[model samples]
Target: MTRGHFDDGALLAARLLLAGLFLGGAVQKAVDPAPAMALLAMRGMPEFLVWPALAFNALAGTALVLGVWTRPVALALAGYAAFTSIFHFQPADPWQMTIFVKNWAIAGGLLALAVAGAGRLAWRGGR
Candidate 1:
């Protein structure tokens, strides 16, 4: 494949994969917000915070998949990933540490996406 084609495919894959991760989280929260609410309560945040978080994940994930406002969406998601990593910041637990680091890694990919933009293959939501 040509370089442009390869890049386009890669970008599309990244968008899909990244969006899928967030969408999955959103689904989990929606299906049983009690767990999220419990977590929020433990953190002293309002239980209702889960609703907004779920909404954000759904919207941002859809935006990435649809390639709408690609750069800005990517940047926002990157920030979200980094910020959410704090929740997994349990260094004593190997699993939590792994997730925390992985969140940072995902944020890195999102930063790259923001720099790269959506390219010609993007749907762009009919701007």
Candidate 2:
């Protein structure tokens, strides 16, 4: 079809994929929050804030997927991802380092979404 239609489709796909990553992680964490909490505690996060973090993930993911106030939602998620990457610093370990890099990459993608927006296919009427 037209270039605009293609771009919108790509944007929609990217938004869905990025949102799915957060949603899946949130679901997994909700299923087993204790381990995540322990990890967060090790990373110096307060025990009281664990549930709030999980809720943030779920709500942010939902908001992104639904394209509701997408730029702001993506900005928040980008900040959260950046904070989480720093919180879990472990540069000496290969797996941890890879994950650290991945987190930053995800943050970058979220920032891009914040700039490009949800496009025309979004529920909130993007264009």
Candidate 3:
């Protein structure tokens, strides 16, 4: 395969990975929202906002997977990931720090996706 083909494949893979993570989290939250709601409460978010946050995660995740409105969706998810990471930033706890770092990496990937878009396998005809 040509270099372009390889690049497209790599981009598609990255998109799938990121999209799957968000969707999986959304599904988990949907299945048992108590944990997620408790987390939000711990973060000092209003109890009412938890449902909207869950819906946003699910819808944006679905959009990412579909590759429609790729750039904006990616940008939104990147911001969401970054925002969520802040709550996990526990300097004294290595495990929590690791999760914070992972979230940052995910945000970075989403930012890159926002710039490059969904390549060659997107519903909006790809980039």
Which predicted model would earn the best TM-score? 1
C-alpha lDDT (0 to 100) for residue 64 of candidate 2: 78
Q: What is the TM-score of each candidate against the true structure?
A: 0.91, 0.90, 0.88
Using lDDT, give the best candidate's number.
Answer: 1
Task: Evaluate model 2: give its TM-score.
Answer: 0.90
Writing each residue's lDDT as its tens digit, candidate 1 over 1-127 gives 3458889989999999999999998999999999878867866889999999999999999988988898999999999999888877887899989999999999999999999887667795566
Query: Could you give the candidate ranking by TM-score, starting with the highest?
Result: 1, 2, 3
Give candidate 1's error at residue 18 in angstroms.
0.3
User: Residue 30 of model 3: what lDDT?
Assistant: 77
> Per-residue lDDT of 60-105 in model 2, one digit per residue for the tens?
8888787888899999999988988865578678887887888899
Candidate 1 displacement at residue 116 in angstroms: 0.4
Predict model 2's lDDT versus the native.
0.84
Write down the lDDT that model 3 would get: 0.84
Instruction: Write down the lDDT of every candidate, Cα atoms only.
Output: 0.90, 0.84, 0.84
- Per-residue CA lDDT of model 3 for 1-127, tens digit only, reads 4349878888888888898898888788878888777767888887676678778888888887877888999999999999999778879989989999999999999999999988877776543
